[model samples]
Target: MHVPDGFINAPVSVAAGAVAAGAVAVSLRGARRELGGTSHAEGGGERTAPLAGLVAAFIFAVQMLNFPVAAGTSGHLLGGALAAILVGPYTGVLCVSVVLLMQGILFADGGLTALGVNITVMGVVTVVVAYGLFRGLVKVLPRKRRSVTVASFAAALISVPAAACVFTAIYAIGGTTDVPVSKVLTAMVGVHVLIGIGEAVITMLTVGAVVAVRPDLVYGARGLTAPLKLRVGGELVDAEPAPVPVAARSPRAVWATGLVTALVLAGFVSFYASASPDGLEKVAADKGIDKNVEEHAAKDSPLADYGVKDISDARISGGLAGVIGVGVMVVAGTGIFWSLRRRGTTDATPTRVPESV
Candidate 1:
């Protein structure tokens, strides 16, 4: 969940900020290896960087849809399980972080002051816990696309409550208000457990869709299925490698399709999202978690609260904001990933000397 300003004390917020900064720095370096490593181990193909970027944008778009969970509470995609399963864990962290940064600075969804808190709880914690659980589950389950889907569902389901617990712990230590720690812990985890079901369903569906089309592109599926062993007279030997795909759809096509879907979801489908408060906000209001909550610095921005400033029609204003958010997120994410991909190339490329030397 996006933590707004003044939820936690200043000291804890600053500490969380430092932790978030370090986590992001580590993710940037780790993403190079995940994006640029040898084929089959990292991304599906050479377009890994762009694919990762598109995944980030897709996460941003889907997160706008706050589907109703229970009563007046609603939940949206966290994207940690989705990204970690589709791309890689390191890149997943970077993906959610990018969304948080954009939301804080431009749309005022998350607070700039609590940016680090959001990143730490939503990005780092979710990715780590979900990915860890995913890897472990895949290890024990049957090595198949279905197994990956199941693991994704389970991991994503757990991650939401895990993040809620983490936030509760942080609040216990650094809450600005006098809300009881036990109550906050119970409410946050309970409501988010319901939210986690929504997360699991979305994660399972998305991961299953990708696995069906391009299993190779799924990072979590990599290496799960081992090469076949064949009996060669007396001793067993490795079976013949599968032929390279010839008529398979181009990655650019897949990317374009995904981008279009994101635009459609954000621009139009988001209108149906629940008007009630999300899990975190509802818990906060009911529990008085943020008595010291501060106004968002970007409250006056053109796209604050996911609506255009001057548009009179609710549908039109929200639609425009969503479209703008998708466009900006895609551009920003693509640029960052492209630059990282280039850097990875530079690092991998060997230096050549002149004949004169």
Candidate 2:
């Protein structure tokens, strides 16, 4: 749900800008820790550099295919769940940033000046809230692999409502029009609840697939123990293999899988996606706030609204757009993640106190 320009007033947007800025500041330190103390600076710098751009592009493309739920309302994958699952949380924030920047500049989706608001509402808050809850659930629940998927689903489901509530609170503080806060809250939450279900499933599936393939690579699965049955009657027993070296595994393979998944979702599957306005659009139209929407700067772009201009073949045009979007997002997301990963190292050594102290 991109909060376009003019939905929230200037003062509130600025306030959100402040909040977003503070969050990014906090995430920098958080990302450092998440990446581990700066000791073994080998693989992260390169792998994480491209992930930044990839994150942005991924979020952008995924947000396009709004799945329908109710009359006049639809929902799409927010990527908060997906990003936090695939990449670390701090990098997740950066991923959303790249998507917001590209959307505002190229897609004319969210407003340029209001980019900060979109980032705060969609990027920072979602990652912080989702990742925090995801870790907590993982801690409390049974340490089964399925638990990870279950936790991912729940985290994604709750995050959307939380985001809706946050938007309502933001609008209450800086809404441009005199719409009733309750109506906005109800509608936004109501529609987004449906969207959150979609998010949960998508997040779980994506996370599950990755975990199954590269359990060691997933940051969330770090501490969980694998089964170790003792030898019986001198017969050999099968066991889960040792964790893969993050460096040994090919980034290109991971990127290819993720990019293929994104392309399929956006390119072909999106054709059958819901054709209704999303939560924000429905609420705005219902609440009369849509009138205040300013023109998107990129409206004149040929690729505006997820279609190539004058392309008669719906499948080809839409497919090309999806492919391009996937390419952009993968490259962009990879760049962002790679950059953060570069600044970081994989070592997890604890700092020791000085003997004198």
Candidate 3:
């Protein structure tokens, strides 16, 4: 649901911009902890930074592959649920926000002026709702691999409609047109529910796959397995820690694999994505919610609309654009995460212990 320019009045858009800015500020601080703070000897920050970047790139690639939801409506991965499960909530928000930013300025998929709305709805709302519910479910459900996947599915499924409702509420307050709020709400929620199913399945499979290979890398699965307890005297004490697996200590393999997957998805598989309008696009057209929609400022960019400007072949043009997008996203995401991780590491540095007297 990338809100284009003119969908919201200036006042409300500015208000939403403030909210989005605040959310991003908070997420930046929170992401530092998620990236750097870990009890592992291998340094959680070092291992997690690259993975988080890959997650962002993967989300960008996946969003290009829109699956058909209704007769003429399609939906794509929001990435909040997947990112939160893979990384953390704060990082998840940043990931989606980065995607939205790139899409706006480069691809012209989302509007530059509406960046705030898109970030608030697609980035903030989806991550908060998905991660909060995911944590709750993880707490109640059995601590197992399956439980994480199941929780991911549920969280992703709910997050879509939750975002849709939030968008409807925002539009109700400052819609540029005279669309009925009730009708918009009903239609948005109804269609997004189906879209959520697609989100859930994708989340479930992706989380399950990652968990199967490296559960330790998955933030949601981090503490799922409790430490072994040993009875000593009348009390139970934690057993000695197990050695870190050789494979788990390094993220290079996983990073390479993930990057390759993202490249393939965006560079090739996206060509098969449905041509139908997405849920929000369809709703806007049908309900006249886009009556005042303005043209994208970057409409003339070489990569606008996910196609190369002078490339005659649709396949080559789209694929080149997609590849470029993935590359840029990976570099941008990794740089941001690495900076956060460095700051976290500095903050978490220990004071020098006094040498033995």
Candidate 4:
């Protein structure tokens, strides 16, 4: 959920900001390994590096297509579970954080001052909880493509409510309104539970589609089975690796497909999405949590509220804004990922040993 400004007092907001900063710092370091081919199949980092950016853009697009969850309440993709399964946990955190940042600064969908809280709750909490649960489930379940999808569904389903609970806890500590913590908690959790189902279905379908086409590209699918070992001269050695298909070696096809899908979702399909308030928004209004909500600092931005300023046609203006958002997100995300990938490669390089020594 995007916590707007004035929802949290200054002290607690600053504390959350520190926590978010620390989490981002750690994720940056971890993303290097994930993008450097150290954490997945051979050459996976190179392939994954490009896909990470596309994943962020896709998440941003999908978030605009909210679906009706209940009467007057809607929900959208959070993207943490999907990102972690597609890329890796560290990169997943960065992906969601980037989307949140873009939404806050450009779309005014989230509050500038509450950026830290949104990152902490939506970015950090979702990735950590979803990835952790997905990993655990993957270990206990059968090692198959279907198993991975199943795990993705379960992890995604739980992450939404988990985030809601965390937000409730944060509000309990520093809520700016006079609402009762118990009422807020009950309402938040109840609505979010319904929202989580939609999240699970979306995650399952997306992960399954990618895994069906290119299981090697999915981080969570890696190491599903131990490599076969053969005995040679009374010693065991790893079996010969299979050849990778030429298409699999190049990420261009997948990248193009993903980018096109993101463009379609945000630029065209979002027009049909539900207009009802999302779970958090509804709960906030009902529980008086918005009693102290402040106006977004970027309320006058050209792209504020996912629409272009001075554009009379609602469809054209919203579509243009969505397209712009996707473009910016992809460029920014790719730059960050590529830089991390390069740094990782450099750090992984071994110093040359002297032959004369």
Candidate 5:
């Protein structure tokens, strides 16, 4: 959920900002290793570096579609589980953080003042919880593609309520006004539990689709099974590794397809998404959660409220804004990931060992 301005006090917000900053810093370092230490210049960076950018753009686009969850309440993709399964946890954190940054600066979907809170709750917390549980589940379940899908579902289902609880705790600590904390907690977690179901379904479907098409590209599926071995009368025989077929589409082609899908979702499909207030917004209104809510600083921006300022047609305005958002997200995310991937390669390269006397 995108926390609006005044949702959290300045002191707590600042503290959360520091936490978010540290998390991003650590994730940046971690993403390098997760990208397989491949620089684009070396022609070895296709695995997760570019795909990480696509993941970020895809999450941003999917989040625009708010599926109805209850009476007048809708839910969108948190995407921590989806990203973590598709990419690695560190890269997943970066993906969601980048989306939050774009939404805050370009779209004004989230409050700039509460940027740290949003990143902390939505990016760090959700990614950590989902990825942790996912790894745990994968260890216990059968080492199959289906197991990865199941783990992704369970991880996503839990992450939503976990985030809601975290927000409630934050509000409890730094709330701007007096309200029944218990009531807020109940409402927040209850509705989000239902929202979690939606999150799980989306995460499972997306992860499964990718696993089915290209299991090698899935980070969570790596190392799940060992090489084939046969047992004959108390003797173990190693079988030859099966020759894998080349993918029908090159990595660049797959990246292009994913980018196109993200654009289509944001630029067109979002037009028909439910217009109802999302879960957090609905809860805030019903429970007086925004008693001290302040106007966003960027309220008058051209793309504020997910629409262009002077565009008369609602569809055109929203479509243009969505397209602009997707484009910006792709360029920005790709730049960040590629730079990190290159830096990682340089750092990981071993220095020449001089001859010792």
Candidate 6:
């Protein structure tokens, strides 16, 4: 849900921009520790960079496939928890940032002037809420492979509503039009609650699959203890073996997988996506908050609203956007991750070694 320029008043949008800036600042510092301190340098540098990009592109494509939830309303995966769990929280924020950027600049999905608001609502808030809940649940629940999946589900479910609350609050403050704040809050929270369930299911399945195949790579699942402890002599220890470093995929494999997933989701699957208004649209309409909704600055652009100018076929126009978005995200994410990964490698390398013993 990208908030266009006019929905939120100028004052509120500027305030949101400041908050977003601070959060991004914090995330950059936090990411160094998460990536450098935790992940294996060789593998992380080589693999994580490309993988992060793929994750962003993946989130973008998946978001296009909005599902029908209720009459006049639809829900799409916001993908904060999904990205955070797969990669890391800092990187997840960046992933969502990249998606918003592409949407605002190229596809006119969101407003350029309101890009900060969209990133703050969809990226920063979602990751913070999702990661916080996931960590808390993991601590209390029995640690198992399913625990990660379960935690992911719970986190994603909660995160969507949390984002809705945030948006509602923002509207309460800087809403350009007069509307009842209580009604907006109630509607925003209510519809988002249903959307949360769908988010949870998708997150659970995705996390479960990754944990099954490459548990070690899951940033959230790191250091997870097995549910059952084994008795060894007198004391007990985790039944699971220590995770080994998984090898990076061949370059061809990474390239092929990311591209293919982006293509399928954007091109074909998008056709089946629900036509109903998304969470933001529904809330805006019902709450009368969209009375001042401004047309996007890039409204006249060729790629406006994820369509090409000359393309008569809706499928083809959207398909091209999906592809281009994927390409852009992959390149951008790869660049950022690659730099972080390289820094990690540089830090890990020994400056000097003994020549003789």
Per-model root-mean-square deviation over C-alphas: 2.2, 5.4, 2.3, 1.7, 3.0, 4.0
Candidate 6: worst-modelled 10 consecutive residues by lDDT: 38-47
- Clash pairs for candidate 6: none
Alpha carbon lDDT at 62, candidate 1: 92
Estimate the TM-score of every prediction.
Answer: 0.94, 0.84, 0.95, 0.96, 0.93, 0.88
lDDT of 1 by residue, 122-184 (tens): 999999999999999999998888999999999999999999999998899899999899999
- lDDT string, candidate 4, 130-213, tens digits: 999999999999988899999999999999999999999999999999888999999999998899999999999999988877
For candidate 6, report its TM-score.
0.88
Lowest lDDT 10-mer window, candidate 3?
37-46
Clashing pairs in 1: none
Pick by TM-score: which candidate is best?
4
Predicted structure 3, TM vs. truth:
0.95
The positional error of residue 257 in candidate 2, measured at the CA in angstroms, is 1.9
Candidate 1 matches the true fold with a TM-score of 0.94
| Candidate 4 lDDT score at position 108 | 94
Ranking by TM-score: 4, 3, 1, 5, 6, 2
Q: Write the per-residue lDDT of candidate 6 for residues 248-332, one digit (tens) a residue.
A: 4354454565578777888778877898999888888877788887888778778787777788998888787777777777788
Alpha-carbon RMSD, candidate 3? 2.3
What lDDT, from 0 to 1, does candidate 6 have?
A: 0.80
Q: What would the C-alpha RMSD of candidate 5 be, to one decimal place?
A: 3.0
Candidate 5, residues 228-282: lDDT per residue as tens digits? 8899888998776554457634667668888898889888999999999988899
